[model samples]
Target: MIGVDWGTTSLRAYRIGASGPATDRLDRPGGILTVPQGGFPAALRDAIGPWLAAGETRVLLCGMVGSRQGWVEAPYLRCPAGPAEIAAATTAIPFAGAELRLIPGLTTEDEGGVPDVMRGEETKLVALAESLGTALACLPGTHSKWARLEDGRVTGFATHMTGETFAALSQHTILARTSVDGPDVPEAFSRGVDRARQPGGLLHHLFGARTLHLMGRLEQAETRSFLSGLLIGHEIVAAASGVTAVHLAGAAHLSALYAAALARNGIAVTQHDPDLVASGLRQIGRSLGWV
Candidate 1:
């Protein structure tokens, strides 16, 4: 079976065996956003044509590819849903050589009743729930997610725009003037994390990135790392309030950063493979008797 995680900026296809890890995989920068109108079929063919030619008859996809902007809009399933619900909600798309299905996203509301949604991340949460049972999870990226799993079902979750906000502050705002791209600065990052634990809010804390630089207290190269720590620290303060441990998932670098911030908050961290989407897709496929 072929499992594809086609999101906005990247496409990852995994060739799964009857059991165990993926036998083969393909990675491409051609995400759904790059596919022109009526071009998804061609894009899929281009990426996994060889596997299909080899008689791979089943394909399951997850992520933004199922969004309204992707191939087909697989409507979201409400919170407190499990793999069974996700599998049952999978949306099928017409393809000649394979039975293709798109995993629907998940949605839940905050205390105030505003809705929160997640796409590709739900698959990972499903995989995590299968192993961890009941837990809190943090998936960090452009938009980070804080999800709660209870007995193999996602009870609720929240989104934080830390990465996106960091990008804007470090590249497009006045903060950019003092920031320079460089390797990670652990000291600066830790300092930022410490600052987040102080009394002032995020807005006031953000401006400190500049003032500290002007006062010759922060080096230009450290600005980026510091800003990242500050944002992630604030996110943890808000989202991880009562949790003592969190299952962290994402690219290695980002995961490490989040781990540090989380650790600073006295939270225990258990890192999970970023590619758990394959395991997730497999679980959903199993629920449908397609794996």
Candidate 2:
């Protein structure tokens, strides 16, 4: 079996063998943006062609590759969606002489309003949500998502454009002009979170960073760290306001940053391996009878 978790930035393909696991796996950088409809076949060939075997391998994929902007659009399967529902809703897109089965993203309504949509993380979050009762699973990334789980099933969720906001502010806004990357000062981040938590002071506190830098209170080397803290802190304070226990999944460092911001605010959260996405895919695949 060929398993893939193709996201907006990269693709990972694993060749599962008879020995109880997937092996001979290959990973390559190929995002939907880099490969439009006309370019996806070549992208797939470059990533998984070497592992293909006629009639012996079945490929399963999930993520932005299922989005409208992808090689082929896969519509969302509405909620109460277990593995079967997701499989039943799949759209098959042929690529590289192989049939690629894409899992549908999810759509559900919540108190936050509107039907929330999620790709990639749905597989991972659902797979790891077995911990029992109304879990608040926050997947941190460029488009961070905070979802609700009940009895090991996804009920609803909210997407905070926090990471994207940070990127925009740091790269395009004034914050970018003095911000530095890399982990230099943890103190500045802690301070940023502190500022965001103050009552009715979030918007007011934002300007303080620039003021500090200008007034020579904060060093240029620490500006980026502060900006990261500001954005992450604001997000944590906003998203985690009422939730208690939570699971954060994604890149380790990014998760840690969120962990720090939320933990400081008394919200308990733990980080997990992203490989759970594959596990979710496998479970969803089995439910779909593909296994």
Candidate 3:
């Protein structure tokens, strides 16, 4: 079986055997946004062409590829959703002599009852259920998600624009002028996290980065890390309250940053492999009897 984790800017394909783990993997830059109209099928073929030729006919996909903007829109399932519910909601599309299944996203309300939605991450959560059980899970990226899982079901979640905000500020704003490209500075990051806990809000604290630089207290090389820390710190502080521990899934660097911020707040973190996307697709496939 072929498992695809297709997002907005990237696509990953995993070739899973009838049993055991994925035997091979492929990655491509032809994300949904990169593909022209009516080209998703061709793009997908190019990504997993070899696997298809090898007679791997069953394919399960997750993420933005099932979004309204992707090849076909797979409607979202309401939360508290589990593998069984997600499997029941899967949408199958016939393509290239194969039965392609797209996993639907999840939707729920925030604490204030405003609607919230997530794709891709739900699949990872499904893979994580057996290990993490009922717990809080965080997946940090352009739009970071903090989700509450109970009894292997996603109960509710909230999104934070931390990564997007950091990118905008560090590349498009005045802060960019002072930013330096280098590895993260732990001290600078820690200072930013500490500042987040002060009386002033994030807006006020953001300016402090400039002030510290002007005063010769913060170096140019440390500006970006400081800004990152501040944003991640605020994100954690706002979303992680009352949760004693969090199951983190994503790239190692990003997860490490979130782990640092979480630890500073006395919250424990358990990191999971970012490759859970394939595992997740397999889990959903099994539930649907497609694997």
Candidate 4:
């Protein structure tokens, strides 16, 4: 079996073993955005050719691989969707003369008229929640999401685009010239978290990240960490303050960052192994009775 988590910037694949889990892992730079014309399997095979089994059963994928911008759009199932519902809607796209089972995404609207959509993270969030017997979860990402669940049913969620804002401000905004990578200074990050915990002034605090660097209180590298801490900590404080037991999802690197931000705010966080999406997808496939 082949499991894939294909997103905008990267594509990750795992070759499953007899234990019903991935054995050899592979990664490629080309993702859904990179394959605008759709050569997903060739790209993946090129990356994982050494581990290809004689008769690979199928490729189970989630994320932007099923977005409208992807190789194919697996239309989103509505509110209250489960693994079974997502699996039932899986569309098999032919690539490199192979069939790939694509998991559809989910969508719903909040009270504020904003639309929420999630792809790969949904499966992992559900699977991990079930594992921990957790009923409430917050998965941080380019667009961070807060999921509410119980007994495998996803009740509702809210999404905050904190990661995207950080990227935009650093790379595309005026701060790009000054921003640089630095260590995860706990003190600086904690300051950001405290700033975020307040009920108001996110806009002002956001500007402070830039101004602090200019005023010389923070070094160039620490400015980046400060900005990251400010936005991400603000997101955590706003999203997960009342909700206990947030399940930080996505790639390990991102989960670690969010975990730290949450910790700075005194919130208890649990980091799920990144494989639950595959397990959840496999579980979804088995529940759908896919052969």
Candidate 5:
């Protein structure tokens, strides 16, 4: 069986045996955004055609590829769902020789009734839940997710735009004038995290990034890392309330940054491999009897 994690800007496909690790893998920039109006079939065939030709008859897809703008818009499955529930909701896409299924995203509402949704992350979270049981899981990226799991099911979750906000403030705002791209500065990042616990709000703290630079207190090279810490710091404060530990997952560099910020907040962190998506796809596949 082939497991595909296809998102907006990237596509990852894994050929899994009956058990154990993936036997083959493929990574491409051929994400949903790059697919033409009616080119999903071609794009998919071009990427996985070799495996298909080699006798792979089933493909399970997750992520933005199931989004409304992608190949087919799989509806968002409600929370309190596990692999069984998610698999039951899988959306099937007709193809020539293989059975292709798109995993549905998950949706939950806040106390105020505002809805939050996730696509690709659900697969990883399901895999995490299987290993860790009930826990608070964090998947850091452009939009970070803080999900609550119980008995291997996702009970609820929240989304934080920390990464996107950090990018905007550090690159497009006045703060950009004082910041420079450089290696990670642990001390500067720690300082920014500490500052988040100070008085005033995030808005005020953001301005300080600029004022400190003008006052010669914050160096230009460390400004970006500082800004990152500041944003991630505030996000942790908001999303990690009442939690003592987090199961973190994502790209190595971003995960490291989030781990540092999470640790500064007194939260225990257990990092997981980013490839949990394949585990997730496999788990869901079993439920669907595809493997």
Candidate 6:
């Protein structure tokens, strides 16, 4: 079976064996947004054409590929959903030589009753639910998610635009002029996290980066990491209440940053590979009897 994690800016395909582990994988930058003239079919062919030619007959896809703006809208499943619920709602499409299935996203509400949703993260959550049973899981990205899973079901979740905000401020604001792109400075990052614990709140703390820079106390190269820590630190303080440990799933670099921030707050961290998307798609496929 071919498992595809087709997000907005990247496309990743994995060949899952009958037993479970992925046998091979493919990755490309031709995400939905990069597809030419809505040529999703062609893009898929370009990325995994050889795998299909090798006789792979079934495909399971997750992520933005199922978004309203994607190839086909697979609609979201309301929260308290699990792999069974996702499998039951899987949307199938027939390609030239294979059967393609798409997993639906998950949605839940905050304390204010405002709705929040996720697409690709649901697949990873399925894998997390199976492994951790009940836990708090964090998938940090452009829109980071803090999900609560109980007995293998996603009960509730919250979203924070930490990464997106960091990017915007670092690239589009005055902060950009003072920011430097380089490896994260742990000391600077930790200092930002410590500042987040203080009273003035995120908005006020955000300017602290600039103030320190102007005072020549914070070097230009460390500005970005400090800003990153401030945002991530505030995000954790605001969204990670009551959870003792967080199961982080995503790129190692981003997850490492979140893990460090969480650790400073007395939260233990268990990191999982972002590649769980492949295992997750396979699990859902088996549940649906489609593998």
Each candidate structure's TM-score, on Cα atoms with residue i matched to residue i, is 0.95, 0.88, 0.94, 0.82, 0.96, 0.93
* Displacement of the residue 106 alpha carbon in candidate 5, Å: 0.8
Ranking by lDDT: 1, 5, 3, 6, 2, 4
Comparison by TM-score, 2 against 4, better one: 2
All candidates: CA RMSD in angstroms?
A: 1.4, 2.6, 1.7, 3.2, 1.3, 1.9
**Better candidate number, 4 or 5, judged by TM-score:** 5
TM-score of 3: 0.94
Candidate number with the higher lDDT (2 or 6): 6
Clashes of each: 0, 1, 0, 0, 0, 0
- Give one digit per residue, the lDDT tens place, for model 1 in 1-291: 899999999999999866899988999999999999999999999999999999899999999999989999999999998999999989989998899999999999999999999999999999999999889999999899999999999999999998999888888999988778889999899999989989979999999999999999999999988998899999999999888999998999999999999898899999998879889888988888877
Q: Cα miss at 191, model 1 (Å)? A: 1.1
| Residue-by-residue lDDT tens digits, candidate 4, 1-291 | 677888898888876543456666777778777773647567767765565555675678888878878777888776676667677778887765446788878887888878888888777865765666546677767788888776675667788989899888889877787676656776776667777876567788877777888888877767777778888887877677676567666687778778887777667787766667667666666655643
lDDT of 2 at 168: 76
Off by over 4 Å in 4: 17-20, 36-53, 94-100, 171-178, 210-221
Cα lDDT tens digits, model 6, 56-140, are: 8888899999997899999999999888899899898767888888899998988899999999999988888888888999999
Rate residue 276 of model 4 by lDDT: 72
Residue 197: error of model 2 in Å? 1.2
Q: lDDT score of model 5?
A: 0.92
Worst 10 residues of 6 by lDDT: 17-26
TM-score of candidate 2 relative to the true fold: 0.88
What are the runs in model 2 whose C-alpha is more than 4 Å off? 17-21, 39-46, 94-99, 131-133
The residue pairs found clashing in candidate 6 are: none
The deviation in Å at residue 195 for candidate 5 is 1.3
Candidate 5: list runs displaced more than 4 Å.
none
Model 6 reaches what TM-score against the true structure?
0.93
Q: What lDDT score is found at residue 195 in candidate 4?
A: 73
- Once fitted onto the true fold, the runs of candidate 3 whose alpha carbons sit more than 4 angstroms away are none
Give per-residue CA lDDT, model 5, range 1-291, as digits (tens).
Answer: 999999999999999866899989999998899999999998999999999999999999999999989999999999999999999999999999999999999999999999999999999999998888899999999999999999988999999998888888888989988667889899889889988888899999999998888898989988988888888898888898878999998999999999999999999999989879889999999898888
